[model samples]
Target: MNTMTLWHITGWEFAALAFAALLVGFSKTAVSGANTVSLAIFAAVLPARASTGVLLPILIAGDLLAVATYRRHAHWPTLWRLFPAVAAGVVVGTVFLLWADDAVVRTSIGAILLLMAAVTVWRRRTADKEEEPESVTTRPGRLKARSYGVLGGFTTMVANAGGPVMSMYLLSAGFRKLGFLGTSAFFFLIVNVSKLPFSAGLGLIDGRSLLLDLALVAFVVPGALFGKWAVHRINQRLFEQLVIAATVVGGLQLLLP
Candidate 1:
């Protein structure tokens, strides 16, 4: 396999990646689904498979920041209910990765992004109607959790694009702002951390990737800080619309020849 070194990246490419890294942190702290744009940017800048490897560490860094900020608000019961199915889905995703080539992976990531964006839009339309929070103890709730867990695990493992899916689930469960951020914080941190070995074994994460991550990680901190500050002040509807638009553009770019 060819190794990507800093020398291989031009100044413009580095700038693009740095901006994407910033978005990763911003997404983690403020808008959970917004990172789909970051995912697209990374994949467009790097090889599809290698992009996942490189982006993983940056995401983990953002997750750390998110956990630090929202750790106390996490709903552990919800997490527990989602884990087993997520693990199963991860296993299946790993198998798929083992067989898929770059084209397949790129196409898969594009389709997942578009699908997630559609789900987000649909969820948002019905958001006001879900007055009561969904419960995991009930049969219907358990089924919903299992289905989302599997899909989240698969999409995350494939492209690190599980945020929108998870966001939709939490919203449907009637999570308010802080609760949504807190739960997603811990969820991605644990899941992304667990994925390290798999990514390494798959030759996605390597010395070269780490080198790129080192350069990109610093930008995440400031973005996180900005997101923390802006979360309360920003226009929520406008931001969501922007996120959806960016995700759609990214997905389309990946799908087109």
Candidate 2:
């Protein structure tokens, strides 16, 4: 929009995007898994495919803040194992994006979220009954890393909505709050930055989207600051449950008529 109508968007649309941006910041530092809410909201307010482009920069901003706060705690071995698979997934996602229509994309994202939520629940329940060693059952083996990494990369590249996949993987690997946040923070910062060239090559990122990002980015700060405070005090079990519940809700919202 021109200077005369720089603020041309409707109030509700502005409000939705700002709210979504706020959620992006909070999810980055706190839950590390609830960002699908932000993704869903951004897609609801913008075009489904373009929303991924517009939100990427804002996510990177939050990623910087989170990594600064939790840099010391990242598990490098896990990152090393996952990166190659993640790159493979990104390439796959790029190919997929070339052919998928908006409806197909929306359906794919919703289906991924719902499927992930189901997998998380099943893993949780199985772990509860079997009671295997944390080392045996919870850590990311090569296979686990490859599986989750590929899915995380594909989901992120497709919708800017891979938080749950990575979150579920970390949680299964038995990362407590700080470790979870630190590793996820570092992972997304790298992965998201890596996606910039691909998104640009696809002509997904442009001046108008950047302009909208500029308008909404300021709202991320307060939410991120709040997340840092909340993470320190939140009950761990409750936090995990909240993340899963929110994931399910966000997935369903994307699929609803």
- lDDT of candidates 1 onward, in order: 0.81, 0.82
Number of backbone clashes in candidate 1 = 0
Q: Which pairs of residues collide in model 1?
A: none
Model 1, residue 74: distance off in Å is 1.1
Tens-place lDDT per residue, model 2, 168-236, is: 787777766777788889999999999999998887787877888898999888889989999888876
Give the per-residue lDDT of model 1 (tens digit) for 1-257. 35544358788999999999999999999888788788878877787788899999999999999999988778888999999988887888899998888788768867876887788688678656534332221122889899889988987898887787777677656665666788889999999999999889898888878988999999999999988997777564565565567667767776876
For candidate 1, the lDDT comes to: 0.81
Off by over 4 Å in 1: 123-140, 235-250
> What's the TM-score of each model vs. the native?
0.88, 0.91
What is candidate 1's TM-score against the reference? 0.88
